[model samples]
Target: MNYTLHQLEIFRTIAQLQSVTKASEQLFLTQPAVSIQLKNFQDQFNLPLFEVVGRKLYITEFGEEISETAFKILEQVQSIKYKSAIFEGKIAGKLNISIVSTAKYTMPFFLSDFINANETVSLTMNVTNKMAVLRSLENNECDFAMVSTIPKKLKIERIELMKNKLYLIANRDFNSTKKKILLKDLNTNLFIFREPGSATRLAMEQYLIEHRVTIRKKMELTSNEAVKQAIIAGLGISIMPVIGIKNELQNGDLQIIDIKGLPIETNWNLIWLKSKNLSLVAKAFKNHIELKKEAIIQQHFSWFNDSN
Candidate 1:
């Protein structure tokens, strides 16, 4: 602290604005205080830093050189501070998180593991569809979002958490009649789907469109539980994440059809803003989620094999 960091900060601000008065206004100090600091800086340099000609203040050549060096020194000091924080293992903060509706089952269990290890940190959770999660990231509402669909042109940075697959689910009665069915054959049956902008629903629609299959009639539901209820009630069939329907599928309330190219495989990703400053808590949460996501998925959906 030989050369006060505060002095360099004031000098940099003054250099940027090219006006002592404006810097003082922004820093919440009086004009006289800014002037005194500037005079102190000049005294330390043993020279005049600025030449005030007319109403404008212009920096001298020596002042320009000092300004450049000051910025570099300040940046280095900040880098050291950041590195020191990471080494100190100080994990105590709240992290705001939003995830796709289906992630409610898996993400919480994974986060529970983190909570067990770090008793100091707390989590605030939001379960929403992909579009809302993307909106949360854009608006700085959430520190990170867990989603299957990637948004376009949003400047989001995504890390692949794990591979997740979408499956065609039906009531046990439907499975008893036809253990195996064709995609073209299922076109005549009524379809239950998630609402628009849902990544899983979108993927299912894309697959149907690609295969030239159209449903006889369609019903849109808000939650996976609702969709599963509709299917188990023998109302219609729907496509959803395998992880989301594990319990029912295992309990024989619902079953997956062995159809060729029916279930679509996809990756789950954690996304956040590229420009926002990631807090220490947020960074720690992201690292923990990404590093342990795969194992969590496996633990929850161990019955489902990775093989095609």
Candidate 2:
């Protein structure tokens, strides 16, 4: 390899810390030395990796791609180093994890419990949408990801973590003539939805398609919080993760419809690269969730009328 591992390491550090000085301190090198290493790595790519303006370094477009690739390269190198260290028997490293946004509500509690139990380890979490979570996992940007959507043909191992049910929620102001709502009844009603590529949105779409329900165009939103706000303001109904809307339902800001025979089921899975050697932290997390999956699901979804 023409590019030195040190060069890739410096680039990765700068990308993460976003400052040469911070990268230098973390790596225990002088700022000028860090700058020199970054420049050398940029030269290897034949492109300026970062743009400096008024003492602030912003990663360029191409730099972001390089930084992502460099992250994977450096992480693989670290795994090798960790293996070598394990020959002497030691365990230490931060485990980086990412999860889709809708899955965020429960992840913190479980993750905190795990971290508290494992004093020798720490974790970094990236809360993003489905596409970003997939991208992060594919680029080795994260060690593992908890996501609702599993892509076809991706070389990843997935362990079912939990089955989450979907709920059609609306504000009290939503006045429907029918007692039991049907998919076709929502045609005239306003609809609030997660942006394209959201698994919840996809599931809802698939259900509508399968039932041959024609939906009127309404609002498209990105976050569950935004969808909740719109629903609370009487904008429309939405198909949302039951876990995500528990507080709203309890507060009476939202009401779940007893829509019989509608598509109401989904699952969350823990995903990781099949080809990449699994880290101890990642394996532990996967095992922990697998073992406790049933209890967690029961605790969360027990109150629902539809127990299945």
TM-score computed on alpha carbons, candidate 1: 0.67
lDDT of each: 0.81, 0.79
The digit string of per-residue lDDT tens for model 2 on 10-75 reads 888898889999999999999999888787777776677889999899888898898899889877
**When superposed on Cα atoms, how far off is each prediction in RMSD?**
14.5, 7.4
The regions of model 2 sitting more than 4 angstroms off are: 1-91, 298-301, 304-308
Candidate 1 Cα errors over 4 Å, as ranges: 1-89, 175-179, 294-301, 305-308
Per TM-score, the best of the predicted structures is 2
TM-score of 2: 0.68
TM-score of each: 0.67, 0.68
